[model samples]
Target chain A: MNKSLSMLENHPHIWRAREQSQQEERFSLGFDQLDEALNGGISTSGVIRIRTLTGIGELSLFKHVISKQRTHKMIAFVNPPGDIQAPWLATFGIDVKQVLIVKPSTEKESLWATEQCLKSTACHCVILWSNGVNTKESRRLQVAATHNDALCLLFTRPNRNSMHNSAALQTLPISLDLCLNYRQHALEVSVLKQRHGWPKDSIAIHNDWTPNNRAIKWAVEHNKVKRHVLHSVS
Target chain B: MLWAYLYFHQITLDTHEKASLSVGNNSRYDTKNEARHKRTGESANGQHQPGKTQTPAVIVYCEKTNHIVQRNNGALQQGIEIGHGLAQAGALCPQVCIIPFSEEDERLTLVQLAHRLYPFVSDIVIDTHNTLAIRLDNLVHYYGGHKELWSTITHELNLSKVSYHFATAWSIEAARILALNGVDNYECDRDNIKHRLSQCSLSLTALDKKTKEALTRVGIRHVHQLLAMPVHELGRRFDNNTISYLTALRGETFPHVTLFRPAEHFEHFTLLPFDVENTQHLTPFMEKLLGYLAHYLRARNLQTSTLCFQIDFREHPSTQLEIKSALPQSTVDSWLSLLTLRIENEVLPEPAVSITLRCDNFETIEGSNGDFFSNRFNEVAQKQLIGRLNAKLGEECTFQPKVSDTHQFETMSNAEISSSISASTFTSDIVPTFLFDTPKPLTQSTKVCFGPVRLHSEWWHETPRKRDYFIAQTLYGVRMLIFKDEDNQWWAQGLFS
Candidate 1:
């Protein structure tokens, strides 16, 4: 207490509180372990960049987050206009009207739209899907996303080697990896990184609204990927 | 060429039951019954003191209905109600078709057919509104006079089963009267127009009077009588409107007819069913749209100086970016390249569903000569590379100072990474350019520890951050987080960039 007082006296301005309080407007990510892994939840701080190999659930994760935020705020999808697989997002609760999709006529338009979404305070989240995001552009969006207090997510299908080679990459204080658990009729999610506390192990989520009996039976039969549960315990 | 006229053609079908059922109402028949009950004339006619033994005048009005003279086994003459008498027509023939006569479509068709016959005539105004205004003055000479022109028009109209009464006169109104009442279809002319008018009627009914008393009072009737009236007296009695009407009838004022031609706006676009994920897929389609837009622009001698790019995402919404240029060029290649550079670094978190290009900042190209030689090959290539770097690094990792005269550090804003950077490159002023990344929080000795920089944005508004900023070092001497407080207190913001 005396040391704290001394530090405060020297500074004359810094808070001496035990907990550094931040704004609380977090959303449930559906997966409890993923939420726990992301320090409470993905930081609504700024733009969040998610890099993945093709067909690695980047788009699915984005759809999931958008579904969660769309109830209270507007979510935008900036891409080239195309037929969105409506059935895929139905289980996650995203419908046609709630999603505002933009397909820019030009590449410049795509970037400009992303910038606009980040600046839009009314927008809860902005998702930009493109095959061509580079380091400098991602950083710029991150700054804009942070300033607006709107979540900006970038989807990139970066190879493992390219991900490692991206010099501008900084460890995301929060990250989650969603994988298709073959044995179970659900996705197995694990936290790849966390800033605060270690996230609990991989949790096997059964098919949407799957009964507990089926989930338990599947888990008992295929427990090989259940090492995440053990890691959380230790 | 003919009289200036307004013509309306209405076609009515006997669909009382069918129409009512189609509207989903079964009570329409009852409503019709109620309407008939409220109509007082038919029921009250005999009750009114038996009209004091007064006999209602047998009104002999030929109520005209459908006017098409159709051929039944090549027969030319047609009647209004062949199957039923006038009194029982509605009940006996409940579904008879009523087609109001149209002079416009007839005249238009005649003029079109005439144009083909008289190819020397550069233009023909189809007086479709009036039935009697077919011109023979110019065409007569082409066909060697009255007989040939009349035969041609008659034969053409007859082939289409269209019965027409033809007349010739110095004025269109005279021709109209002659066509309606003449014995010979083509014998009426300038000399007989006055004689025909005088013989027709001397009552106001001839001038289209609707009331019986008014028709009787206008004893000074006939078109000739009305036309021969003193201009001043006509004006004082009937107002100035009659002067203009008489003037049009006497051919004193000529009406200029405008040929119908489609107006062109010079704009076009292409649409796709799905968002273009691959630039390769979008490039060719964009080229086609731009090609059409360019052709339209060139045809109008105009150019687009600014263009906008818009993309709609599958999951969320749309995004738009505008690109402004100092020059205008019709080529789509440059635009595609520039746009590709901008989007080259952008990652869409969702698949794009659609894209659109909007062009604005239009201006006249000034001359027919087109000369464009400001090749931006190197600049475009550099921009593409920089965009890739920036997208990966974060948009903040690149900055071009948006210079302003302000003492506060935060107020010193920077322009975004775009073409605007090169515009300000010529100036020699000390423009402080900052890195795109956030400045890392620095750790130092704290006589005055990291502070909450008391930044009251404006006193009048909900002022943000009465921050007191600080820089504090760790015990191990490693530089660390910078902090700011609300009321001149401390909290970490970021690390030094």
Candidate 2:
């Protein structure tokens, strides 16, 4: 016997209305800057590709938003467990209760687990390590995530030579690496692509790590040594 | 336990918008009449007794459901906030609360509840993704046979405000058919099986009738009529295994059901994407995974005795490995520490692809009444230290017995070789403490920092060469790691990390 018929045959109106509403409402992260940049903070209901350079603070940005979520959200880290730095997360002020993690064995297993999580209503967000994700695999995950109204964040380490464009076609709205600066321990963020409005102007963010004594002292000493060398060269 | 599966008919705000008073604070609705008109049961002061008022309260009715699903509150379904039906319900009605019908939530709740309840039953098998089958034979007696179990289940559903339909039969197929057909209650016995089949509307396909003439020949007018035929003659007259199926459905023969699967290790975890570097991003996920693995093992009366870590680069296509313990233990701490160690020892050529901790060996563990002792058994400090090291290095750099192959180092092998222990089955076989397959040169003068240690293996092999290995330091202050070739030449390997 088909179970779906028993579940849906009697409630055509409800099922249809839910389907329609889910389609009409585009989900957002509620962060105006990031939301505007990526159509709306990663489609609340689809797989989203967010790419960044290796050294840039892309992971930090994703974590900051995910950490304080009051809503029930599950995040699956496809990246190797050690790749993410835990201490850096506390600095961003993320809460511990609202998130869940899943570590899959291989890339194939990782994708499978991710797809399973996306299909589950228990999870609100699925963040994947998209280092080797192809367009087809990415699309498959996006479809699964969207079907369940869960958001998918692809933390991509882009090719050093080529700009990553998988998200451009997969997501209705897209945000590309505009630009970021790690200057004197400070971070400045810029938007390169915006599917919504004129992208926000470049914003400067203070690096909390820089304010610590050890980091500050190290920066000061390093700068002094560089200055002395420059003077001697002149 | 008395069980009742109930669905709430209606609940809404327009009825109570005027209820401005807080639970103990001032009132929003001016008079009791306004509150009485709403479909909901209570008045602003919380003093209104149910079933005492002249008119019922308005409650939200589930628009999706039909049939006996709506036990009460039909009037609230219309725009009427205060309906007469709702006012009569008991404050804690077995059926009145608003329970969201989410498939995800239902599945999650079922799994979690099942985990907690396994000890009470002989076995419990959950069919996930709607395809996996579960056999309930052994568990039948534990729940006090079919009648007692179904009644107990019905009681639980009433408490949770959930509605479900189920049955017990000789075959899983028959049970599934009965449950899906809205036949909520059942007792699978020899005498009642035919009566149940007779009550069902069996289509031609369900009965496997070839054509209208074939169906009429047996005078099998209805599903029940066909079920009365003899099994052997029915098969001879018809095609395929239809007769066998009929017999099974009638309880003459028992059908096979899928066996329950128990996890080797369990985990329960949640993860959120924080900034890339914070390893804590994985803590919740780790915790959840461990919980699932633990619970899975417990269901099978087993425990994970050994674990291995698989760490990947987030940005690059490289993998690292780490080994945690020689012995098996089922706890979050052990899994976490092994993960940490793997993380520290390996370097991500890129950030990280993903991290996985797999516990392969499970030892039978007696069910313990209290979990408090298990929580205190593992060390948090060791796990934390391992996690730190993993964050600084990579997950793969650390090596343990299970994850790493204990193969002899050969001439072609690098300093770090994947372990072969995965394929080796010798539980007690002891090989040499160290076996180097790659023989170094007997002599080298690049800067002899340390003396040579002679090495030999596979003495039976005809082409085996006797060689000396030296740990060296170069004049440039760089450690000149050189190996002597069997031909008497020296090759220098790079400085280690």
Candidate 3:
């Protein structure tokens, strides 16, 4: 063996990449492609931001992440915009008993709830839907997440090009930010900000709805054929 | 063998003071004036009589007999006596102020005294009327000795300014007899109890009035004279009850003293020093009350799930506010935080003069030793956070999702955020995670991706219905559950991740 290869073989633990050093400490996002893109999966510390347009399948991504979390740990949704369809989440293999929904009426209360869930070791993952969060609140949430080793995912709607102010866009934290949108009936995930390591510009994931749609089309065509045969016999 | 009895000498007077003490710097006379002001809607400033100010002279009038029942030191110095007619007492002490006696006030004061002494002794028996008999055998050594224990008891009583007479003996009966008859302090030894009883008056023993009169007729003026007679003859002469009382007092027989047990619930009331017109003034008082409650809980190894506060106003009916915890809590800080959050939104309807705190739903904490590891610490912190949030926001706003067994889409799941829900009993792989509150109509151009599961109702309703359910995909690539009715119209039921 080469001299450096022999040295590396002697102490493999010390020579591994820093990102892969604590592999067990991180939770997989359930997508091997996304995991490889982010240098192993999401770290079970600090905060991750996912910016997307309204009604662009943010909830579906959240359900996928929630299903990947450990069954024993609780998953909290702080101030979600709409009613959470429990049956739909159950279909994605998420345990309903371990899910907590906090609907805070005000923006201030929503931020507080997010921070509390992040600081609590009882919860394994927190999905926060916040419209406009400032820099200070984001920092507080990041510290809390680090304290408990909890995965915090903040999903926000992209700033609309309406009359005037861009305060929400300007205040985005300089951390890992991913932009998700629909492209040709598939999800297009792109990395807009990366604090460390190399990240690919974009990736396309075929929607999981393809097989279900094909089955539905076959059923509909079969039903139409049976109806036509009955009509001809009459 | 060390036993102590506390006799509240003038419980009626103390009860009167208790009601007025919270009004701040107001004497018993001012309390009467305030009561009069409440009834007539008149201010107390003009109701005061001249020269009656600060004269220690005070009178307690009994309405049933229309006579003076009690008098203060100033009245005593002026030669006022009990059982005198109200007219005569008023004439004798012109500067004296009179207040009516209330039985309710006296009863509440005695209960408060019992609560105060419970920490020092566990086996306390409240004697007839205004006496509390405490068994201080093993407890005396805890305070150094009998003398030190007595001093400690007196110190506490003096701090509360309770007018009390103390007595101790080998038996509870002897101590009560000594304290009732103006023998201020005495510690009778077991060997010399007979000698001690010999000096006590015959009227002080627990004998009926008829038996006492019969003994008096026979010229028995003291306990020794009654003891000189033959036992059989005494029993035949005055009845078995008198003989039994004599035997119990002399330490020859054990008396059946009904031991007092404090109620299992916690109830503490205090008259505020000043009227609480706003909720902010109540913080200190609430903290003090919570501290006492925490002490009680620690001693009993119990935690409370619910607590209620009753605030009494001078003119309005008392208002009640209840606070509930997500879990049984014993720590003072957790309870204080919840209480502070609850009081922030409360608006006081009237100025509160007194407050009462009570809790009955107490649960015994599982482990006596709170040696919690990191995991248990986190669990407690999470519970505290949930409790605070529920208290600040409404209970309905926070919950965990509960899955139910049902074929209907929306009915399959509901929020089960309350602690009362049992652990998950059932799980289904077929149920979708999200179901719309109401099904939406689907457009004709929508594409079906899966499912032609035909479902028919068993005619349970007035109309039997058939439907074909299908998994469909919107143009936006959202997976949805759509169903076609018997009329061939389709509706979007739910979405799948």
Candidate 4:
């Protein structure tokens, strides 16, 4: 019985329902409802695909998660849709030294750079803003992310002239596929697919989550006051 | 100090041999040369007679003396001697390639060899263009002993594939003289060196011809005979220079060299044994050049951000290709990948006879005494990733973004108009991460989530701008940074992405 227990403990492929533990460390989404719906939260490593139109609260949805990944210093931006301003990244508590911007001349180079950044140990988060990625390229990126134990986020904008079909997106070797949309004062997030899990219906996050907005400051103040009250009572 | 000296007997001839031997294997586009080859009664396929291909056709001729100063093994086997003229070389080996001896070229080859041995022996002096003297007293301990140090030196020299004669002695002069005269031995004991030094002819010493002849007249032919004479008598008979020379050779006085300090920057020039035209034919030479650079950087514990390659052709103007990196990089594989990519895009105007690698800036990193094979990512791996990207895409394509000091935003993301106004005009707080290159016309019916804030450019600007910016959301909840220009027209500035 002890030998079998040791084997179960050592093997990464085996999952235990009683322990409520994951194969890899999971990062909380900072929302109670969202965390429950997604089983625990986002994974610590592996590829995550986000499909949405530009200019919504797409990046803001993950801004909290990016700052949470403090294990490795670098956060690469490969072929971002636009210039990711230094002050903006700083506003989100990202150090200027941690930002590596790569503007590849071609789509192939963009894919290559994404893979290279995912494999580099100095980088904890690699955000690639690609028009689209094929199944083969996504598989390579996933492997690189797993080897370095870092998060690789592939951001794609769905539009009229989309290159790949829904079939290609379905077969991508990714841990999660989340679609984001911004509605008045809320973000509509729906889990399209997740590893070893079921798809979830869309949920409107009623809280204001826009970066550089008043809600973030309000939340900070609220947390400070709550901490002070608890300390005074103790 | 115990010193080891190396004499490159014929570096020029050896290099020439290696070049010719490699380029002769398969050349397909030489019909014009074939006509000339027929006139010279040679094979059209570049193949030599069964036994005649033993060495590269090499001869270094001195125009001043009208004689062959050096010859390769092929020329030696063909019975050409040192005093042979062009006519004699032609008669001995009809296919022998004769090149005029150049003092500058020979000196460059010597300096290149010295660079290879710099890491092994720190205190070294380029005694002459063709000879080097290295102080091994300090390095002997690091390498375990004199034998091990000598083995390391010989190992590096053998990699260069040059004909060299080396010896170790109590003094630099003795070692140099012994090496130049082909007294090849590794017994570095002081007594053994002195015994060998005693047998060298007086003519092998650096003494002036007038002094050597004068000493010969007195029957002092060998070193031992010269040493047997009284110093006072010798000083009385010889000039001050001769006595100092004797004192230095005897180890009583030391000669100081400028010390071959590996230069702050790297500059290595390689002359091909044969002119090469195709890109495929040049990778080997480039690899060898980069190998030398890698060794050079490792010895000095240096990293370079930018390095250039200069290619010289026979008639066309030479061109240079410069490869730059965002971070200081030092490694053979990293630089080779970048150089090969750059060479792929470059078009050679003419066949290149020589190539020179030059680096102007070097950063000396600290605490570099680490593992040679560790692959953990750090500054090295980061630089490698950036370097590969820059080489394939372009240099400016990869960079760390920095905010402009002016703080004024651009109408478009990439096309930032630098001549902007003060930072005080844009402090309203709600800004977006992504901006359009040019303001797009607002086609969507939007709801204003924030108030209109007035914005203006510097008054001194040629086209001063006045606008009202607002944070707005469209019907689909896609938030945008929009503005109203002086024309009362609405435009979308950027995305909240």
Candidate 5:
């Protein structure tokens, strides 16, 4: 309506406080710390990097978010560390049949599989766990994900030294980067890089394995006495 | 030199009819079988019960005929002979299956017969459209004698299930004349062969109508009379071609026989003009090889699934590389994609020398069915992705995760995922995010966060195992599914990713 408002809408680099219709659809991670740290959670597409080791709260963190992606489409796991347990996927209320696993022997093949899945219209999301992805590979993955508007979450195992520090010296156009850590046997996650928001502090979720177990104190109290005793005879 | 002539009069028509009938075995083709049974004059199926009453006379339709060109014995029995018009044959026999013929199919049938007899006889000539002449002069010693060679040839022809009329004489032309004259017996003795050849009519000698009519007008209708005439005397009436034919047929002179060489896939080996360092420059050579391959595929009308090339080097052992297409393909483009993908990665150990390209199996091109009303989700693209993965990576590498109602985690993911997952109902028990391909022995000390859920193999299974499972977080905060077996050995199975 106004001259200033028209120029503001026309400007390419300007960020606007538009209506909900103009805003990208955000999927809440179902965890307050992750949603708040990710600034209204992740979208349906774009590259998100998770810098973590093999086993952490990464799967449980995005359990609810991944299920919200199109159910008719597929979710591909490229070079996953292990067999994606169907029962575990079932626990998240996602269709187990919608999961496709491509186990490429080499990192080059893993990147190819990731790009193929991202480019395919049938696949909605891709979870990649190749350690060889760098700035170029991450950018390539981002471009491939941008085609057909699919989500790609790359899980890179950070260096032993870099895992502790929030290394923000990045070189890729990554939307979000979260590093998972453990503190006193509880999972703590913090944002290493964010596209349009400030990186947030680490948040501690108190579930060790099962909910409300308080396993750190219980293991110290119970595991010490019965370390070597056998439970029952066959 | 002794020669044997094998004449397959019904090979082309029989093969054509059998091909269409066996392709689908429609009920409509049942009449063709009845015709063949009565034509072969054998009731192998016992369906020739009414004797030729309902047998359809099988005749070869001459595209638009002034004449009926070919016929089976039952057609002749019905008085619908060769040279009779279609109108005449139709009037004679109401139930007739007039099959059209082609020279290409006839040549292929002849080559197939030659292929069957190639191993037994060394010097066999594809003499004519329906006749094959085998030179027993040199091959008789190899197979012990003429009788053995003749018997082997007959045995092979019988095994091919083709109706063949064969005759042996001193020469190919004499043998052919005797064969077409119905002297289809293994007569190896020279006198008996001469007697049979002398009795053969001039009609079976492949002479033109004018020459035969002139010879017949002079009361010389048999081979004995033609052989009795002097070449110069016959030359006064007949041309030099007929004179040469008479001389050759009488065994006075030997005829040149071009021995048949079995067909092989066209192969090419090209040597580089100079030692090319980079593989990029060698595309010219690869182009030449692929061009030849395309011509070969087109010429033979064949589709091949696998192609290979042997790359020679200056010093290193020649490397053999194989390229495969996802489907049987005849075009050069389909193979070029795989070829570029294969050759781009191949690092030649030494400088180039030459390349030998080949197709091991030439598969006949088959028809493909296309879907007109497919869904909008781009299933073809999805399938192409799968096929590319199968071609580049391995087919076994891609899989869809499925859930089976089994306590043994190994067998659960292997089962194909059905549409309705009613077999799986998520329980409240703690489940790990990722299951290890194989369980490893637990060496590190870990704290169990949750308790023992007893899981074991079925009692009927071999080597049944029992274990108490727990959700354990490692010292580094990696949550895993661990178990203590009946042997009291601790093992880590998987992780909560």
Candidate 6:
């Protein structure tokens, strides 16, 4: 057998293995601890589900991901819970002009709009608010988000007490599932599901209120004294 | 200095017929008769109605005198002649249709023709009469040669079924003279301009009737005979105006005509062969007009921010639809897509007889510097998305979110997005990504994370607010911006990651 012919035969086999590994590559979430726990930040080809209570910093975390990425593509918000406050988003270093908000009137429309935005080359990240979306729609969105090298972040309320497993917990389709809850003045993020990695214990990120904290403390003390005097007079 | 003059013969009559053809298969004679009956309140009696016997007929009207000016072959056979009054023509040939002349439609038709020819030639001069003289020297090579260019022009005219007389010469004045004198097709070369123009009759010159009669009395029947006279003697006899006219006619001097400058705004209208009942049928026409508009914009290096479509109905008044873009666009495909979206959403009130597309809002595009990795493609893609979304949903729906400088959560505004956000205005602040419309009351179990910021203002309100804001964490492991009012009521205002 000729040495060159044998090497050529092995070339395609090597290329196929490399291509398979490339498909499994992940995108860093810009948090080293979170990335370490998830093996990578999240797979670039699958959906990331964050199940939490309504007012926790889920949107802020998504904004963190967007601001950290170097891409210039737009970030789309589909069926947000309320009117997106531009000033609030700007405070997080997320460009307000680069954000596109779609307020769909119905659940079907919300799903459609999200799918369209996810597939469009115009959007690099699509943040969807999924409250009552069915499992079928979630699977469809997961496929669309993974079709290109864009990120799809799904935020939903936690189904903590459901007897049947929720879509967020069912890891058949999603690449990563995170459960975020606030505890003891900190944000606690725990990996509930990972495609090819072990789940790590919850990581606590301490909240920093700074500069404003002193003013709030002073105001609280001042208000307490005023309330005491008013109560005594009454 | 090669110039081409196009004369639309019987423009008024042709426009009327074309308008009739657009509305339906009914002839212009029938529509005019019907209109006349409606105005005069004359019932369609057997004797009052023309064409009752199904015979070929013609009717010409004089606008100034409101009478018949000329008769066609059919009416001539029936003893109707020039200068016959409307009633007199009708009595003479009871079967001939007499319709009033519409000078407005004629003028509009001429303008439409000029717009169609503007792309081929830049220097177009429309005379008081229905003649359009265009400088064709620059365009001959583009169309392969003089013959090819003339053939292309004639082909377009034939497609529109327009009756025109075409003549070319070294000067616009000579071309206009030859075209107005019923020259269907003629071109004068540089060396033959004098000899060819000399053969033209004196009636074709720009001289007044009195001057023409005086020349004829002096036995000067041909332009060559007039040119034979000494220039000084001719000027002494007929004044300097005639001498200058002859100079221009002989191609010795350029014609002193007002050079036609296209309007800053664009308007192109076409009469449809049949009434369009649905918008889908108008796609081809709309696409062609958009192509013309794109060419016009590209020629001037301009782009339009807005476009309007006016749909003229056969019976009812026309309706107008306006389409706007988020950014200046000169691409035909972008405009066509937007137009398609709008047309799909629109329902016509009546069948359309004609359509006029107009755009007035234009902007000059600044040339972008080319780079190996420029963000131009991304910017274009983003604009395309905005255009599509706005076309489908509506304007003001797709917007960029910006932070407002206010302490109240509800008062934070989301302004409509334009082309781009100013980079200098983006500053980092300590605010959450999602702010609730109305803050939610928090339970006592919610733990305080970090905040105790005090925001107290709006004293002018009926109930001034005094609140202490906090960065709190809920049991669900989410960070929130919580505030407590003076009443000691705690509410969650926004979310943090």
Best by lDDT: 4
- Evaluating just chain A, the predictions reach TM-scores of 0.58, 0.57, 0.76, 0.76, 0.76, 0.74
CA shift at A180, candidate 5, in angstroms? 0.6
Supply the global lDDT for candidate 5: 0.73
Q: Which sections of candidate 3 miss by over 4 Å?
A: A1-24, A53-71, A85-95, A158-168, A184-186, A206-234, B1-378, B415-430, B443-445, B462-465
Ranking by DockQ: 5, 6, 4, 3, 1, 2
For model 2, residues A1-234, the per-residue Cα lDDT tens digits are: 578877777764433423322334454544465555555554346655554443334445554345544243434445432322222222344322223344445677667767766665555666676466666786688678767666677666434355455533233332233445444444555555443334455555543321113455677788775345544855
Q: Could you tell me the lDDT of residue B428 within candidate 4? A: 21
Model 2 lDDT tens row, B202-231? 552244446435776656556666666676
Per-residue accuracy of model 4 over B185-295 as CA lDDT, tens digit each: 876677888888899988889999999999899888999898778889998888999898788788887666788987667889888766677666787777777877877
Scored by TM-score, the top model is: 4
- Candidate 5 docking class: acceptable
Query: What DockQ, between 0 and 1, does each candidate earn?
Result: 0.01, 0.01, 0.21, 0.23, 0.31, 0.28
Evaluate candidate 5 by giving its C-alpha RMSD to the native, one decimal: 22.0
Worst 10 residues of 4 chain A by lDDT: A207-216
Among these predictions, the greatest DockQ belongs to 5
Tens-place lDDT per residue, model 5, A68-184, is 756657788889888777777777677876787899999999999888888877788888887666787788888888766788888888666655444333546767787788878
Instruction: Encode model 1's per-residue lDDT on B208-290: one tens digit a residue.
Output: 44332342466654566666777786666553545665665566766454443222333222223233455544555555556
- Candidate 1 structure, TM-score to reference: 0.30
Report fnat, model 5: 0.65
Q: Write one digit per residue (lDDT tens) for candidate 6, span A23-82.
A: 465667566777778666677655778888766566555554677664467888887776
- Residue B90, candidate 4: Cα error in Å is 1.0
* Candidate 6 deviant stretches above 4 angstroms: A1-26, A43-46, A132-136, A165-168, A183-186, A192-234, B1-380, B387-398, B402-405, B415-430, B459-463
DockQ of 6: 0.28
